[model samples]
Target: MQLTEAHAETGMTLLEGPVFDEDGKLLVVDVTAPEGEPKVMRVDVRRKTSQTVHTDGRGAYTSAQFSPYDGRLYLTDFAHGEIVSLPPDGGDLRTFFSGEVGGAPMNPDDLAFDEDGNLYVSDSRGLTEGEDIGRVVRIDRAGKEATVLADGLAATNGISFDADHRGLWISELTRNRISHLLLGAEGKTASRHTAVQVDGGLARTDSIAVDADGNLYQGLHGRPAMAVYDKYGERLATVEVPARQAEGLESATNVAITPGGTRAYMTVSGPAGGYVYTFDALAEGIRQSNGG
Candidate 1:
């Protein structure tokens, strides 16, 4: 298959945290660069109209999603290291989780919830001074203790569980690999394995989510695109930008596949590339062609 590029719908900035709502609308975190306020933007899947749901006094939103159970909109504040929760109908912003782990200075990059309503956060903490002991934290529904499921990771970024709730997948950014952990049957050890390694030299994967067929779609930073991989870590296919304007790399920082698996949306953060791109999934074609 040949590379194809679709221009962003226009007038978007520093887009990140792309997610799909149950109604099939596309929601993205819009963060203006270097000191811009953060806001949650919603795109009407039917009308294709984009509007802001909420704006932050702090810089752009890190990540966000519409809670299926409560219908509240939750977002991460990268600049302040706080989880901002807004009511379903939109109201005063409140801090959901501020330093859930002992007030450790860190930022919440991505998160996922399970069928049982357990929330998991992909925290990217200190990485420069070797303090990059990121974690997969599990927070109870009552907003109580945030238990560390696992630690000592390399920039833990995005997370999602399998459909059956027996497995979890995490994006280890610094290591440039996805780690799969089998959930314990009865508080047992979470068996872990390398799901897939980033090819083409550390694409610097940002956020990842699973498709209906159990395939994983990862954002390939520094190379404006999404890399598709099977459950067994086989490269299925790559969807990339059509035009490479300059030598400087374009980074696709976040990704979300719609519930139905027909559309895949990714966020780009390059100077000329901070808009979301949409793609139609061809799982059968990708798997059959093998990296086509």
Candidate 2:
């Protein structure tokens, strides 16, 4: 189904995160809404209709993922530098994570959760050449404390754990690269290195998801496509929006493949409007693709 809409009346809407609830409803966030406009929406995948689930004059909710432990939906608030949560129906509005962490301010862009309920957030501070302002932080299972997992990044965007849950993959927007981090004892980063480099002449990668076979569905911002890369960093394939459907759509920001589901649901937005596109995933979708 083709879904499109403009935020307010400005002929613009920026759709960021795409996630699926336990009941199979697709949920997304509109980052370009006007004050008091709805930011979170529940998209009827089968009928291609959308309904507002949350709204606020403040907060740019970038990404949302259902936690494996608590089953609550967790989100990263880029505008407020915080992490928030709500029930599947979008009520409660609990501030899950906020304020400064690791002695540094947070500009959370996205989030991923481990099976143990530990949360990982992308602390996006934009590009600072020669200085890594962005970071990845781990909020413990209790949501009581945080630890800096990886620092020295530029505009860190999407995040996902490997199929085995032994490693993590992060997209560095400013650098147009993907790096893999090996989790050591107690979840500290054991080692890391750039695994894949994108030819983002003008656009970098955004949110990402992993398949059961360990392939990465790398979403793009400023481009109408998603690239697939193998676990070893080999380019598998790229799915691009057809030109007929690309005029008003600027990017395919984030892709979510529900665990035990069939299709890859991509959230897109541009100067003219926002949209959702789909593609058949090469491998079975796993837990990592649901949001992380």
Candidate 3:
């Protein structure tokens, strides 16, 4: 899918979030949509058509996911330093999660939810305060408790859980490495370690998704590709952008596979405009892929 002339804008246009709602609607966020443009778009997977479903006049929507419990769409606002929510119809937009955590800003880049309704946030600010200044936060099922699971990261971007849901795969974008945060029995405390280290060359690690078989899909930014790795950090395959559209669409930011299915989709944007490319999944997608 490629942006039509109707999407022409003056400044940069970035498409990030690529998740399906409860109704199976594919949604993506335009993080840099200029004034008077819709920041969110909905695509019909079969028809290959898209529509402007959300235009709030202002905001930098980095990523979006639907709450499994309530079915409300939640977005990570990098510009507002908070997370916001609304109905699928784009009504009643309201702040869902905000404020500081661990005395540092909540520069949320991407988010995912576990089956038990716990929300995980990739708190990233790109080393604003100091080197390796990212943090991972988890919000309890009740949405009241926001606990810091891990910190001291360099621009942590993507986040997802392993097949067992016993740990989270976090992407350190700056270092081009993925870390596995193995949760303790209580699910609060965790032990972390470097899991997959990639040599992306010009591409930076962005969002990630996990399959039912414990495979991790890591999105690349400077290049139109996704790297699939096993739970043990072994590279499996590289999902590429469509050949015809590979010329100028290098800003591949995220991927979302069909839950329990073999369909994989990636959201990419660049001078050519924002687009969604599809491929076959290496394994069946799981809750971590849908993020709902």
Q: Which ten residues in a row have the lowest lDDT in candidate 1?
A: 283-292
lDDT by residue (47-160, candidate 1, tens digit) is: 657765666456546677655556667777766776667764456887777764855666677777665555677777755555658877776655676777777888887677
> Alpha-carbon error at 156 in model 3, in Å?
0.8
What is the C-alpha local distance difference test score of each model?
Answer: 0.65, 0.83, 0.81
User: By the lDDT metric, which is better: model 1 or model 2?
Assistant: 2
Q: For residues 160-200, write the lDDT of model 2, one tens digit per residue.
A: 99999998999988888999999998889999999999876
Rank list by TM-score: 2, 3, 1
The digit string of per-residue lDDT tens for model 3 on 48-98 reads 888887887667889888887777888998877888888987878888778
**What lDDT does model 2 reach?**
0.83
What TM-score quantifies how close candidate 1 is to the native fold? 0.83
Q: What TM-score, over all chains together, does every model reach?
A: 0.83, 0.95, 0.93
In angstroms, give how far residue 283 of model 1 lies from its true place: 4.9
How many residue pairs clash per model? 3, 0, 0
> Top TM-score: which candidate number?
2
* Winner by lDDT between candidate 3 and candidate 1: 3
